[model samples]
Target: MPPALLVQATAVELLALYRSRSASPVEALRAVLAHVERHGAPLNAFALLDEERALEAARASEARWARGEPVGRLDGVPVSVKDLLLTRGWPTRRGSRTVDAAGPWTEDAPAVARLREHGAVLFGKTTTSEFGLKGLGDSPLTGITRNAWDPRRTPGGSSAGAVTAVAAGFGPLAVGTDGGGSIRVPSAFSGVVGCKPTFGRVPAHPASVVGVPPHVGPIARTVGDAALLLSVLSGPDDRDPFRAPPPREDALYLGALVAVDAPGASDALDPSGALDARFLRRVRVGVSATLGYVDLPGDTRACFDAAVALLRRLGAEVEEVAPPFADPGGVLRTLFAARAAHTVRELGPEQRALLDPAVQSAAAQGEALSAVAYLEAERQRAELALAMAVFHRRFDLLVTPTSAGAAPLIDGGALPPSFAAPFSLTRQPAISVPMGLTSAGLPLGLQIVGRHFEEALVLRAALAIERESAPLRAPPLRAS
Candidate 1:
C-alpha cells in the first residue's frame, strides 16, 4: 500500500485504514512521519518527532491486526500531542527554554498515557505558547507556528501548532490545552473544530496551572474526530487533585453523541443529531457582538448576524441578551495574574527576562495582585458562572463572535479579552465553529456557549451550523 493514497482521512478514516489491510499500521505511521518531516519546517507545526519509536509501535499494531488481536479503538492512528503536555519521548518544554530537557518525565501525563494505551501512535509534539500563557503562537524555544491556510496570519494560540498540524494534514488528530481560548481560538483561526470540554473533563496539571485555570482537550477538523479523541483522553488522573469525578454514565459525551445521532429524532435530537431535542422554531439565543462592551468590527458583527439568521432558519429563536454580571474581566485579570505569578515567578531571572514580552508583562502584573484581590476574583468568578447559568436558563444558548474580527495577521497583537475569557473564567463549555470567511479570505468563527458540561448540545448546534456553513476544503498543501 502506498502512503500517498490516504483518503479524506480523519480519525475515522485512519481507523478504517487499519481495519482494512490496504495499508499496514506501520505504513500509516511512516506516511504521517514522512509528511510531517517534509512539512514540519514550513509550518513549524511540531516541536519534536519520534519516528523510530512511533514506527515500532505501529509495527506492533500491524502484528496485532494480522493476528486478529483486539486493540483500543485508536490502535494505529498517528496523533500529535501539544508540547505543553508531558510525553515520555519528547521534551515537554511548554514552548520555553526555562525548563531543562534532561529533567524528570519518565511517564506520560494521564491523557498522554491513555492515548498510548489506546494504541494511538504519539509521533511528535506540537508547539505551544510559553507556559501556554498567550493566545498567539510565537515562543522563545520553538519560534512561530504558521497558519496552514495563510502563513502570514496567526494560527491562534497556546494550541497554535496543534491545530496547524491537523489543518496542514501533518496528522488528523492533535491534543490541545486551553486556558483562555487556547484551543478554540486556534481551531477557529485555523478552520478546524476545537473542543475545550467542560473544565477538568480531560484532567491535566501542567506546570502552567497553579492559578486553577487551563484544560487539555482535542483539536480536529471535525466534531466527530474531536469526540473520538476526547473519549480517549477524558477521565480522572490522580495527580490533579482538582479532577472531577467521572461524569454520570448517561452523559458520557461520545455515547451521548451516538445516542443523539439516532434517525427521525426531531424533538429528541436536533438535525445535527447530538442534542436531546430538535430545534424548535424561535428557540431563544442571546446574540452578543461583544459580550457587552468589547468593540466589534462591522464585518465581524455582520458575519455573526448571518450565523444567527441561519439559526433562525433552523427554528432557533434569536434574541439579544447580556449576562447580568458586568466587568467580569477585572476578576479574571486578577485570577490570571495571581496564577501566572505563582507559576512563573520562580523562573531564573535570566529566563524570565527572555520570556515573551506580553507574558512577562502579564506575569509582572499578576505578581502584584494582593491576596484580597485574588479572593475577590474567585468570588467574581462564582458570580459570573451563576449569571451565565441564569442566562442560559432563559435562553437556550448564547451566540457570540469567536473573535473581535477575522483571523489576525501572524504578528498582530492578541485579541481583546471578551467572549472567550469570560466563559473560560466561568468554566462553561464553549465551542468555536467556523462561520464563513471574512472578505479578506480568513475564516470567521462563531462561539456557542452551553450550560456547564452540556457539550453534547453545544456540539449538536455546532454541527448544525457546520452543515449550513459548509466548510470549504482547504486545498492540499501542494502535495507537501
Candidate 2:
C-alpha cells in the first residue's frame, strides 16, 4: 500500500495487512510517523512522542508476526496514551506546568500496562487540559490542540489530543480519560468514535481528581477498533481499589458488533468487511436532541433528528422521548469543583502559580462550598443515577447529541457538554459516534447511552449507526 493509504488504515486493517504479509508494522509505523512529522505541530496533538522506542517496538512486532507467534490481541498496533495516564519511562506532565517533566517515571497506569502486555506499540503521550480539568483543548503546558477539521477550532478536551491524533491520522487508537465528556467531546468534534464505559469498568491507578468516578476509555476511527481496544482495557488491577469486578473472563467486545453466535465473525465488521446490522432490530432507542432543558442550535438539532431517522431505517424501534430528567450539570459541577479544590489545596505556592486559572477558579469554588453543600450534591448525584436507571428500564438505549454543537472556534471554547455531563454523573456506559456533518462540513456526534455495564449494547448500536448512516469520511487534514 502507498504510505498515504497506510497512514489512514485502521488498526484492524493494519492487522489484516500484517497477516497477509502485504505490509509490516515497521512500514505502518514509518508511514504514520512521517504523517505526524508533516502535520503534528499544527495540531499540537502530542505532549511527548517517543519516535525511537516506537520504531524499535514496531520492528519487534514485525518479527513476531513473521514467526506467527503474536503475543496478544493488539500486537503491532500503534497506540497513544493520554498524558494523565502514567506510562513507563515517560513523564506524564498532564498539560500542566505544575507537574515535573523529568522523571524516573517507572510506573504504568493500569490501561498502559494492559496495552503494553498486549503488544501495542506505545508511541507517545497526547495533550490534555491541566489535570484534565476542563472541556477545551488548551492547556497551560501544551498550548492548544486544534481540530484537524479546521485548525482554528478546538478538538474538545481533555482527550483533546487523542481525538485530533486519531482524526488527523497520527494513530488509529488512543487512550483517553473521561471525567465528564473528555473522551466523547473530543471524539465528537474530531469526528471519531470514543467510549466512556460504565464507571470503574476499566481500572484507574491513582484516583481521579475530576469526575465523581472518572473513566478511562478508548478513542478510535471506528467502533470495531474502539471495541478491540476496550476489550484490552477492561479488567481489574490491584492498583485500583475501586475498580469494578472483572468482566467475564472471555469477554470479546469486538464480537458484540457481529450480532450473532458465530465463529470468525469479527472479520466481517471491519472497514472493508460486511457489517451485520441485525442487532438494531432488537434495540429500543429513545432519542432526545435536547435533554429537556438544554437548547441546541438549528444545525445541531437537524443533524440529531437525522440520526434518529437513520436508526429507525436500520430496523431500530426508535421513539422521540421526553428528556429522562432535568440536567444534572449543577450537581456534577459541584462535585467536580470539590475534587479540583482538594487537588490544589496542598500545592506549593510555585505549583499553584503554575496551574490553569480555570483550575484555580474551580478550587476556589470548591473551597467556598460548605461540606453540607458538597454532601447535598453527592446525594443528588445518587438520585440522578437512579432516575436514569429507571429511564433505561423503559428503553434499551438513549441517544442524544454528544455536544451542544459542532466544534467551535478555539478561542470561543468547545461546545459545552450539556448533553454529556449528566451521563457522567450517572456513571452509565456511553459512546459518541459521528452522526453527520453540518452544511459547512463540520462533523456532529450522536451519543448512545446504555444501562451501566452495558457497553456491548452501546457498541452494537454504534456499529449500526456506522453501517446504516453515510460512511464517515476522513477529515480534511490529509498528510502524506
Candidate 3:
C-alpha cells in the first residue's frame, strides 16, 4: 500500500494488513516518521522522536509476522506516549526544562509498560504544557502545539501534542492524560476521539499529585480504535493505590460488552452485535448546553444543537436539563493550584526560572492557600461527585459541547471554556467525539459522559454517534 493510505489507516486496519502481509510494521513506521518530520515541527507535536529504536522495533515486528508469531494484541502497531508518561528509554521531560534528561529515567509509567508488554512499537513522546498545568498547548519546554486543521490555531491541551499527532496522521494510537480537560479539550479542537475513562480504570504509577482527577486514556481517530487501546490500558496496577480492576466479564468480552448492553443492565442484552440501534432505544440523555455556567460561543452552540437532533434521530430521548450543581471552577482551580505548588516546591531558583508563567502563578496561588481553604475545596469536590452520582441515576448519559468554542488562534488570549473539568473532578468517564465542523471549517465536539466505572456504556454511545455522523475528513497537511 502507498504511504499516504498507510498513514491514514487505523490501528485495527494496520493489524489486519500486518497479519495478511499486505503491509509491514517497518513500512508503517517509515511513513509515520516521514510524516512527522515533514509536518510535526510546524505543529510542535513531538518532544522526542526515537527514530532508531522505532525502526529496530518495527523490523523485529516484521520478522515475527513473517514467522506468524506476533507477540500480543498490539504486536506491530506504532504508538506514541504523551511526554507526561515515562517511557523507559526516553527522557520524559513533562514539557519542562526543570526535569533533567539524564540517567535514572529507568522505568516506564504503567500505561507505557503495558504498551511495551503488548509489543507496541513506542516511536516517540509528544509535547505538553509545563507539568500539563494549562489548557492550552504552549509550554516553556516545547513552545506551542498547533491545531492540525489550521496551524494558526491552538490545539486545546495539556494532551495537546497527542491530539495534534493523531489528527495529522503521525500515528494511529496515542496515550493521553487528562486532569481538567487535557485529553478531551484537544480532541475537540483537533477533531478526533478522546476518552477520559473512570478514575483508576487505567492505572497511574507515581500517582499524580493532582489527586484522583487525573486519568490516563486513549486518543484516536475512531471510537473502536480507542476501545481497542483501552482494553489494553485498563486493569489494576499495584503501583497505583487507587487502581481498581474492571469486572472480569467486561474485560474478557470488551467488544461484545460495549456494543449491546443496555444502560445499567446487569446482564448482556445482546451479544451478537446486531442491536446497534436498540442499544440506544429510549436511552435518556440529558443535554446541558453550558453545564449551567460555561459561555457557549455561537458556533459551538449551533453544532451542539445539530448533534442533539442527530441523537434524536438515533432513537435516544434527549431533553434539555440543568446540570445538578453550579460551576465548580473554583474548586478545580484550588485543587489544581495546590497540586501545581507541590510539583515545584523543590525547584531551585534556576529551575524555577524555566517554568511557564502560568505554572508559576498557579504555584503561587497554591502556596497562599490556607489549610482550611484546601480542606473546604476537598469537601466541595466530594459534594460535587455525589451530586453527579444522583444526576446519573435519573439520566443514562449527559451530553454537552466539549468546548465553548472552536479552535482558537495560537496567539489568542486564553484557553477556550470547556465543560470537561467537572467530570474530571467527579472521576466519571467522558468522551469527546466530533459533531461537525464550524463555518470556518474548524471542528466541534459533542461530549458523552457516563457514571463512574461505566466506560462500556460510554463507548457504546460514542460508537452510535460515530456511526450516524458524517465521516471525518483527513486534515489538509502540507506534507500530505
Candidate 4:
C-alpha cells in the first residue's frame, strides 16, 4: 500500500495489511510522523511527540509481523494519549505550566500501560485544558487546539487534542479522558467516534481529583476502531480502587459489534438468528432531544431529529421520553468545583497564579463550600444515579444530541451546552457518533447512551447508525 493511503487507514485495516505483508508498521509510522509534523501546528493537537521511541517500537512490530508473530491485537497501531494521563518516559504536564517537566515521568496510567502491553506504537501525548477543567481546547501551555473542519473554530474539549488528532488523520486511535463532556464533546465537534465507557470499565491510576465522575476511553474515526481500543483499555488494575473486576465470561463483546454491511432487517441479525435475532429490532430506544432542560440550537436540533429518523428507519422502536431526573448541573458543578479546590489547595500563590483564571475561580468557589454542602452534593449524585438506573429498566438506550450546538469560533470564549455530563455522574456508557454536517458545514453528533456497564449494546447500536448514516468526512485542512 502507498504510504499516503496507509496513513489514512484505520487500525483494523492496517492490521490486515500487516498480516498480508502488504504494508509494514515502519512505513505506517513514518507516514504518520511526517503527517503530524506537516499539519500539527495548525491544529495544535500535540503536546509532545516521541518520534525516536515510537520509531523504535514500530521497527520491533515490523520484525514481529515479518516472523508472522505480531505482539498483540494493536501490535503496530499508532495511538495518542491525552496529556492528563501519565505515559512512561514522557512528561505529562496536563496542559498546565505549573507542572514540572523534569524527570521521573516513569509510570503509565492504567490505560496507557494496557496500550503498551498490547504493543501499540505510543507516538504522542495530546493537549488538554489545564487539568482538563474546561470544554474548549485552549490552554496556557498549548495555546489552542483548533477544529479540523475549520481552523477558525474551537474543537470542543478537554479531550481537544485527542479528537483533533484522530480527525486530522494523525493516527487511527487516541486515548481520551472524559470528565463531564470532554470526550464526547470534542468527538462530536471534530466528527469522530468517542466512547465514555461505564466508569470502571477502563481503570485509572492516580484517579482524577474530581472523583469517580471521570472515565478513560477511546477516540477513533469509526465505531469498530473505538471498540477495539476499548477492549484493550478495559479490565482491572491494582492501582485503581475504582476499577471493576473482570467479567466471568472473559469475552470482549465489541468484536461482535462491528458495523453491518447492509441497512435493513437481515443485516441487523446476530449470528445465531434464533438466540439474539436482530439486535436493534429488539432494542427499545428513548429519544430525548434536550434531556428535558438544555435548549439546543436550531441547526443542532435539526441534525438530531434526522439522526432519530435514521434510527427509526433501522427498525428500532424509538419514542420521545423525558429522563426522570431534573438537571443535575448544580450537583455536578459542586462536586467538580470541590475537586478543583482540592487540586490547587496545596499550591503556593505563585503556582496558583499559573492556573487558568476560570479554574482558579472554580477552585475558590469550591473552597467556600461547607462540609454539609459537599456531602449534600454527594447525596444528590447518588439519587440521580439511582433515578437513571430505574429509567433504564424500561429503555435499552437513551439517545440525544451530543452537544447543544456546533463548534464555537476560535475566538469565541464560551463553551456550548452539552448533554454529556449527567451520564458521567451516573457512570453509564455513552458514545458520540457523527450524524452529519450542518448546513454551515460544521459537524454534529448523535449521542447514544446505554445502561451502566452496557458498552457492548451502545457500540452495537452505534454500529447500526454508522451503517445507515453517511461516512465521516475528513476535515479540509487549511494550508499552514
lDDT of each: 0.76, 0.85, 0.86, 0.85
What local lDDT does model 2 show for residue 131? 83
Model 3: residues with Cα > 4 Å off, grouped in runs: 209-213, 250-253, 256-275
lDDT value, candidate 3, whole model: 0.86
lDDT, model 2, position 97: 88
> In candidate 4, what are the lDDT values of residues 1-480, reduced to their tens digit?
677787788887787778888889999999999888778889999999989999999999999999989876799989999999999899999999899999589999999999988889999999999988887898989988899899999998899999999999999999999988899989999999999998889999896546435799999998878887888898889998888777544234443444232122123323433222255885799999988889988888888899888877777899899878888889878888888888788899999999999789989999999999999988888898899888888999999999888898978456678899888888889999998888899899889999888887788788778877789667887655
Q: Which prediction has more favorable lDDT, 2 or 3?
A: 3
Better of 1 and 2 by lDDT: 2
- Tens digit of lDDT per residue, candidate 3, span 38-116? 8877888999999999999999999999999998768889999999998897898999989988857899899998898
Task: Evaluate candidate 4 by giving its C-alpha RMSD to the native, one decimal.
Answer: 3.0
**Which regions of candidate 1 deviate over 4 angstroms?**
1-8, 206-209, 255-284, 412-418, 475-480
Query: Which pairs clash inside model 4?
Result: none
Q: 328-404 in candidate 1: lDDT tens per residue?
A: 66776677677678768678888888788877888898888788877787888888888888888788788888777
Residue 264 of candidate 1: its Cα lDDT? 24
Clashes of 3: 0
Estimate the Cα RMSD of every predicted model relative to the unseen true structure: 3.6, 2.8, 3.7, 3.0
Winning candidate number (lDDT):
3
**How big is the positional error of residue 433 in model 1, measured in Å on the Cα after superposition?**
1.3
